[model samples]
Target: MTESQRPRILIVENEPQASEILTRWLEAEGHECVLVSDVDEACQQLEQDGFSALLADIVIAEKSGIELVAKAKEHDPDVAIILVAPSEDHHKVIKLLKMGAYGSVMKPLDQDEVTITVAHAVERRRLLLDSRQTQQHVKEEIQARIARMGEREEHTILRLVWAAECRDEATGDHIRRIGLYSATLAEALGWDQQQVDDIRLAATMHDIGKIGIADGILLRAERLTSEEFAVLRRHTEMGARILAGSEVPMLQMARDIALCHHERWDGSGYSQGLAAEEIPESGRIVAIVDVYDALSHPRVYRPAHPEEEVTAIMADGRDKHFDPRIFDCFLEVKSKFQHIRKEVVPEGVPS
Candidate 1:
């Protein structure tokens, strides 16, 4: 390489004589060099300045050269690290390489071989940096596209929720509260951010099956007859089928919740009669929030129940209607549920 093309190398060595020899040899090869005698000084230089390649001794005072390699990579992931060790330290060389060192040089150092290795390491670092930059650019583009798609999906789901709301007597505020209630419960259950957000959106669609029901059945003001109730129960499976085969993860969760949210922990309540932990966790979570929101808000057949009565009703179903652990978690975050309902459902509103 020409002088202008020569790479800047940081050489970390404890021995003053060895450091001088290595620096002179690298400079003779037209490379810029920074010589530091210990890992601390080497780390300082790494943080304050940029270098194309790092040549560090296998042992520095109170620290292993492997430590320098890790620190250097953290400072500049593209920086290539070469360890200087004895020929008999073959195991150490192999270990360092596995830890992301570029290569190793054995002592007594051969100036020509070291120069060639450093040159190759510098070139390798350049290629890695280029590849990383390209990957980051592509990742940014993909995320941007996904963001736009997410917005469209969100709008479409809201429209579907609105359509379902129109069919049932539940107000728009009921759906909003369900979303918030479910999301809060999910977070309390230690779900990841994406899962929490997905539940927030998917929980609103738990009643979407009502869209498939006849208006006469969905809008009935009185108690449903045994036959009418049997038909109404099919809405769970109907909602599942409506949301089935969706490639979107949120919609997939929505489908599961729609299908199994009515299922009981003791194996007694649904289209499939799944019991205990057999139900999907998403379904279990939605089941609690769905019922809570329903009891707290008015329906065509009944007015909203008081919060105390609502809590007592839910408490009675802890082991049967709801997952025991989830019900306990709900008790912990019950205030958050009340806050969400109050914030979303305006005062004087039935919800």
Candidate 2:
């Protein structure tokens, strides 16, 4: 290698004669060298310079070469450190090699052999550094792709909700609000972040089954007869059916919320009539978020109620209509729900 192409090396040797010999060998081979007489100056030079290789004595000025090697690594983990020791201390040489010293130069240093060992050490460090950079680049690429997929999934879900609302009473804001309310309540329930995010998206589809109901029944502004009411209840089962048969995690959760949101805490609600603990928690959480949003917002058959009335109505259902624990969480964050309500209130509806 030419002088400009060779690795920059720092040589630590307390003996002036030995330091001169190392400098001559490396300079003869065109390797740029920084000569330090002891561990103190070696440490100082390491901090101030960028050296690709280090040729340090196993003991310099009564200090451990291990200390200098460790410090050099802290400055540049990929820096090659070669220890100089006597050949008879083979055990020590093995130990130092295990501690990350690239290699060792024997006491009877031959100029040609010293240059060869330094060259090998620098080449090994360069390969290790290249491998680490490649791994980091691959990791970053994987994260970016995952982020893109997540965005696409969210877009498809919102579009599906919008389509469902085209002929029903729900709005895009309504679905988004359901997701927000569910996430808040789930957080209070001690769910992990992934579970909370899943519920936030899944709860938005609680009324997706309304997509299958006839226009006369689903869009009616008047109270329904018992016959139409029974037909309306079918929306729950139909919603579960429509959302079933998928391995997609959020969709599976959406199916559960759709089917059981109408079920009561006391086993008196609709469709499956699951009692407390019998229903999935996803369904339980959406049940509270759905009814609160429904009663507080105007429905096709009723006017919007005040926040006080909404709470009173919900509180009445605590142990009967809703899960006790979840309902308690709802009470704590009811203000957030109201804030969402005001934020997305329909254009003509008064706050």
Candidate 3:
């Protein structure tokens, strides 16, 4: 390459003689060279200077050059790293590549070979950097758009759940209470923060399919006939179908909860009749909270069951109607459950 065309390089080596030889040869070949004797100084110059590539000896003042390569990659993976080592240090050379070094040169130090190898590594680094930057930019934009769409979906689901509640005498507090109850159950079961949040938001929509039922049937003051009960049971399947094909995880959980919340642990549930662990974890969680909320809150037909009755019924359903392990978790947080119910009291509704 011509003097004006050759790329600049920073050579980091503690051996003064080796550093001088490398610098003089590189300069003669029309490349600019900056020599540094320590990793700290090399790092500072690498950060502040615009060099095309770095040629670093793997063993510098008792520090492994592989460590330097790893640290440099963390700072800027696009910066090419070439480790200079002895031929016998093949294991170290292999390790450097695994640590993200661009390439390696042996100690015999062929000046002509070094120049060509460095040029190739620099070109490869440039192309990779450009591609990575473009991918990052595209990923960021897509994530932002998905977030906005998710927010809109949440608002729509809230409005739909509220509309369904309009058919029954129960206020919006019932839904919000069930949401908090489910979230607490999930957290007690060792779910992470994101999973707990998803359960919270999604559980509020568990009764959304009730919107499809007629108001007279929904608000009947007396017990439903067997035939009417069968019709109402279809709400689980309807809710799942409404939310199917969504890419969002929270909506997906909501769909699962809607469909399987009525499912029994003993394989006696509806639709697909999935039982035990076959049920999605989200649905299992909602099942416990849904029943608890229904018992604690008054419906158009039945008055609220006492807290003792609610706890007794849940205990009975432990192995048959709900997951046994999650049931245990619920029992642990039963006291907090009532607190949440009180906290989510709907607008204009009495505590």
Report the Cα RMSD per candidate.
Answer: 6.5, 4.4, 7.8
TM-score of each: 0.64, 0.84, 0.56
lDDT of 3 at 320: 95
* Model 2 per-residue lDDT tens digits across residues 1-351: 112356789998877888899998888877788998788898899888777788887767225656776888888877888888878877877877887777788987878789899888777866786788889999999999998998787767867876876787677777888888998899888999998889888998888888889999988878899999999999999999999999988889999999999999999998988999999999999888888888888865569988899899889999999999999988998887777666654443211
Index of the highest-lDDT prediction: 1
Candidate 3 residues lying further than 4 Å off, grouped into runs, are 1-156, 346-351
Candidates in order have lDDT scores of: 0.84, 0.83, 0.80
Clashing pairs in 2: none
lDDT of 1: 0.84
* Model 1 per-residue lDDT at 96: 79
Colliding pairs, model 1: none
Q: What is the lDDT of residue 197 in candidate 1?
A: 88
In model 1, what lDDT does residue 339 have? Answer: 82
Per-residue CA lDDT of model 1 for 1-351, tens digit only, reads: 111366789998978878998999999988899988888899899898778988888876226655677788898878888888888888878877888888888888999889999989988877877787889999999999999997787667766687666767666667767777889999999999999989988988888888778878878878889999988998899989989998999989999999999999989989799999999999999889889988887766579999999999999999999999999999999999888777655633322
Residue 225 C-alpha lDDT in model 2: 95
lDDT of 3: 0.80
In candidate 1, stretches whose alpha carbon ends up further than 4 angstroms from where it belongs are 1-44, 53-77, 80-127, 190-198, 245-253, 265-281, 299-303, 342-351
lDDT of 3 by residue, 195-306 (tens): 8878888998887787777866776777899888888888888888888889988889989998989888999987678999999999998888888888887765578899
